[model samples]
Target: MGVGGRFGARESCGTARGVLQRVLDADRGVFETVARRHWPGADALLPRLSRAADHGVLWFAVAGAIAASRTPRARRAALRGVGSLALASATINTVGKRSVRRARPLLDVVPLVRRLEKQPHTTSFPSGHSASAAAFATGVALESPGWGAAVAPLAGAVALSRVYTGVHYPMDVLVGAALGVGAAFTARALVPTRDQARPPARPRAEAPALPHGAGLIMVVNSASGSSERALALRAALPLAKIVECEPQALEDELERAASLARVLGVCGGDGTVNAAARIALRHDLPLAVLPGGTLNHFAYDLGVEDVRGLARALERGDAVRVDVGMFSTEQRRGIFLNTCSLGVYPELVRERERWAGRIGGWPAGLLSAVRVLRADRHPLEARFQGRTHPLWLLFAGNGTYHRMGVMSGRRTDLADGQLDVRVVHGGRWPAVRLLSAALAGPLTRSPAHAAVQVPHLHMEHVSPGTLLAYDGEVTHVRGAVTLRKLPRALTVYRPMP
Candidate 1:
């Protein structure tokens, strides 16, 4: 996992465990009374608080001013404090909630004793109400230390009420407190320091970035899944050129992409991506994939999805060079950027084509798939990188594999210059195999699975041309096609993210 994701996860687990430990051990009835005594039942307060926080968090900080609204000066100051919390809630809390979906005790484990409270009955992770309250209180106090003295108690009470009412646990309040305080502090810091008179100097300005020189040309089969979305992107990134291609127009599209966009972007089915990537070497362009089709394995791996996002990325997306794979038969040469499937997968693709034209989407797709999946074996002779044995199903992927419909294996580093291949041997029948084995999330613990890394791959069948698919398209080849690697081949639009 990335460091940011890992730290966020670790923070979540620690917070949840700490909260649960308190709740699981605490005397439940007592906890409820304590939260209630602070300012009556918090049920009435939280719903309103949550709505305001969604709008902005400054109100949470300003609640103290509301609590002490006797003098006109104090009332005005408290109102401003509320505004700040509102801003903080909308900008900081909302973003943080998505980043850390820590649930509340009531939502997770403890059952609430209902009493007519209006708390949200949704995902209880990290309570937004608590955080907003804490942050607003913290900011108001910072603005005027005397304000802190009054709001601090209120903030603590609000956080505690969540746990006491059985809406949130002790840990939920603590996380909310920390989040609020942190957000208030961060906003304070990010904003210009009110006390400092002389401004801090900024570093010298850098030169405007030079043009990347060349971009990837996208050839989309608009009829495929999301490629139809590309039309919206042209307006966003005027620099990008789009070529709508049919199955037979692969070569012409490749030629245009090679000449125009240095990196060829494909928006279509896996077959279309493979077809373009197959002869990419001869055309001499790198292949950038857009997931515009159903079951987009190549686009999924590429990390570029949806046309709007793709257009935005083009404005700031980096053009990173990645390695390409080659597949060749005796007389024909092709590219397999996603995977080359045998047996069930190859046969499934063929059978589904007719159904695809007939019934649309997952309904027809599922029915067609059940036919191939229900069968036991598709006997075929295969080898990996020229050595292996006679295997039933051998899939040579550019990198990675799938199990029970889930994408499996490490997302291979596109620039690593290696192909990730998987060999599967299943004896399970249709319904049985789908249910028992790969259906659940996560790869099967330790099945008869092996991953091999090879520079070159070749496959042959007993008869003339066995059904071989790149991505998922079954193309007509003379007899054999050689798979080769192309370094720094295509240019694609991708953001740093």
Candidate 2:
């Protein structure tokens, strides 16, 4: 570049800075005048409020209270809220304050008795308290609307407190609030809640009534919580044949039930229900679900919440057609009713299982994530659609998912005939990048992630014997793998109309 071009660029930057500085100075004058007009209650209340918000104590207390609730939704909201507050505080205090140096409002205009007891010494272009307040409120709102609404007024007061206490100008609080909101949104994209993305499924139609399980063969897991309801089921459908099997013999028992039954009934967790669905599809028989496991994700979606509901469905013969996911490789081939995942996830699952008994599900999973994520594991080298990339995780759902959050999405129509595929592209700090993308939102638009919906996919692992998981079950496979959807291949009974 010529000397003249360089000189012109420098001059333009100087001019822009000068204009911004002038605007800042004028805004400061107006806010200073506003601060000087101390109202009756303002003198006593604003200072104390400002002190409460110092170092984000007020926001932390509120978030802690919400987090302490036994309700899952309240707890999820707390996690998001705290995460947002942490992000906003880091940005405003470390980055925003240091980037631009600005002086706080002069205390001379305020009454001596009304002076802020504890004043901040850092640059005040952006107010950290205000930023924290906005971020926490916005994050809570994103997770739970009612809780967010309740906290909004307090958040607003905290933001305004900075100005009222004469520690920051109006514009500082305004800009800080925007930065806080942005931080909350960024936090949300990276650490989304699955419950929010997936809501309860509404039943399509009532099942046709059947004669007390006349042609049904119900496979019950004697070890499952659903087993407690076995007698109830038998009382409800005396003619139905019930086969109680242990966990070790579940597969064989299901296979046996498949050959003899007209409608195969499953009473277990998602894993058991999933196994039954695959068998029912193979034998071309309708499947009835009796919710007897923790979470009961599949049975809940099937619209049969309990044994009674399942019995009602069987009496009515109410059913729905749903898609299944197929996985085929040289060493192994199977079908999944929910999802298939490849990469770090299988390892995480294994780690969780090892500790799930000791720590419980969610806590064990969290510890497992911390353990798996801290390790310097190499990304899985895989080929997809004629392109090779290092991937942290590759997930494919059976059909178009309705609720797309951190967890695999939920499908409204089980027969959508499309697979929801999401891949996290590997890069520096692969785990951190993956976590950020997961929290932030859709990975397709993100450089660290890619997503698509297709009828089928063929994936090839560069190395042999890589671990893969389907419906919470993991296995090792070599070389090329294929996944396709079997549209309307399974008939499932639902109780609701």
Candidate 3:
């Protein structure tokens, strides 16, 4: 309570108020400057642009267009964009706007033509439009740089339109953009990007560097709906022989190609790739995969995403040796490059195949899932390890499948020589147990499901007609079925980072 203490406290309070007043003065000055400035075509363009951004219509349209590309990476980028936008929008509405009760800027100096027809009636401290634009652009860029580059200009224009329309001060848009970027990073922290979760490059292998794909023979499955990609690949590798065949003739065409080629190549989905893998193994040829299907799990995991990536690998002769998963019974045997499963998933795959040709892939998959889960089904009984157990599903991946954020499963290392086995125990509600197991993912033991990594798995006393799905193809197994890995057995082409 002394004189000196009281004076010092008063001085500090006065200084803080002075700084706040100066900041407000500067922010208002900048707003007035932008409002009075004459910019060509902005009067007509910015107001319309700002109006178009209302309720995120512009961003959603952009996302839809990006998703229509039909590439996995494009789809992922679109999803990430929307996810980031959702987070930023939620935060702005819930916290940013509420915490600061600032009013909209004065419209006296702003050109009437540049003003929006219907002004937003909300706090102006942080612009929600700017936040959403920044979040979407940042999120898309995180997943795909090319798409991000294309989207960033639109985002920037949207943010600037907020200020140009006399709706927000410069600081509002800047702070909103900063918060938007923070939201994108927060979204990424919750679900790591694909590049962040890429597996380590190890156990490299050797293969011939065929410039322009001189000795590569590729078979394209016509049923997989990859004709456009096949044509692109043909243009990329002019010297390579490209054979397009029907579904029934795929195996025979692959056999013929493998017999005549130095490097066996295939373009299609996982099932077509599986057939090609078998042929490649038999001929002892290094395989080149071009992803041309709805879900190219094997091709994607191998880092051969498109014709450009595969062409680069072939030109540089870059390659790696990866493990192959095999499942065998008393009557039949087959190899898988991705995963094999028994139980509900196999049935889903079989059902999907039935309707896929008729209704198209994505819609058919949705229909199949609904049909399979609603039907009355019984659990498969089999002996596992040393004891018999009733199981609703048994999934064995060629390599340990890692869970990333909301992503179901992805393998980092393809040559780790281990099988990722997950079993959903039989329970009262099949749907609930299956959903729980899927959400739990790998290396976690739950009442609904248990996951384990093993070099081999043995299941005995299975019925003769038990269905098994491997690499998106289904087959029947009887008696004892053994699943094992072939360590570093398959050589495949890929670009090295």
Give the candidate number with the greatest lDDT. 3
Worst 10 residues of 3 by lDDT: 195-204
lDDT of each: 0.56, 0.80, 0.90
Q: How far is candidate 1 from the true structure (C-alpha RMSD, Å)?
A: 16.5
Candidate 2, residue 121: how far the Cα is off, in Å: 37
TM-score of each: 0.54, 0.59, 0.95
The segments of candidate 1 whose C-alpha lies over 4 angstroms from its true place after superposition are 1-218, 225-228, 243-254, 260-265, 278-280, 286-289, 306-317, 376-378, 383-390, 400-407, 425-449, 459-461, 476-484
- Mind giving the per-residue lDDT tens digits that candidate 3 earns over 1-497? 99999999999999999999999899999999999899998887888888888888999999999999977788989999999999999999999999999999989999888888788889998999999999999999999999999999999999999999999999999999999999999999889887786666667788998888899988998877889888898899899889999989999999999888989999999989999999999999999998887778888877777788789989998889999999889988999999999988989999998998899889999999899889997888889688888889999999988877777788899999999999999878898998888777588898889988999999999877889999888888877999999999999998777
- Indicate the worst ten consecutive residues by lDDT in candidate 1: 197-206
RMSD of each: 16.5, 10.4, 1.8
- How high a TM-score does candidate 2 get? 0.59
The CA-based lDDT of model 2 is what?
A: 0.80
lDDT of 3 at 161: 93
Scored by lDDT, model 1 comes in at 0.56
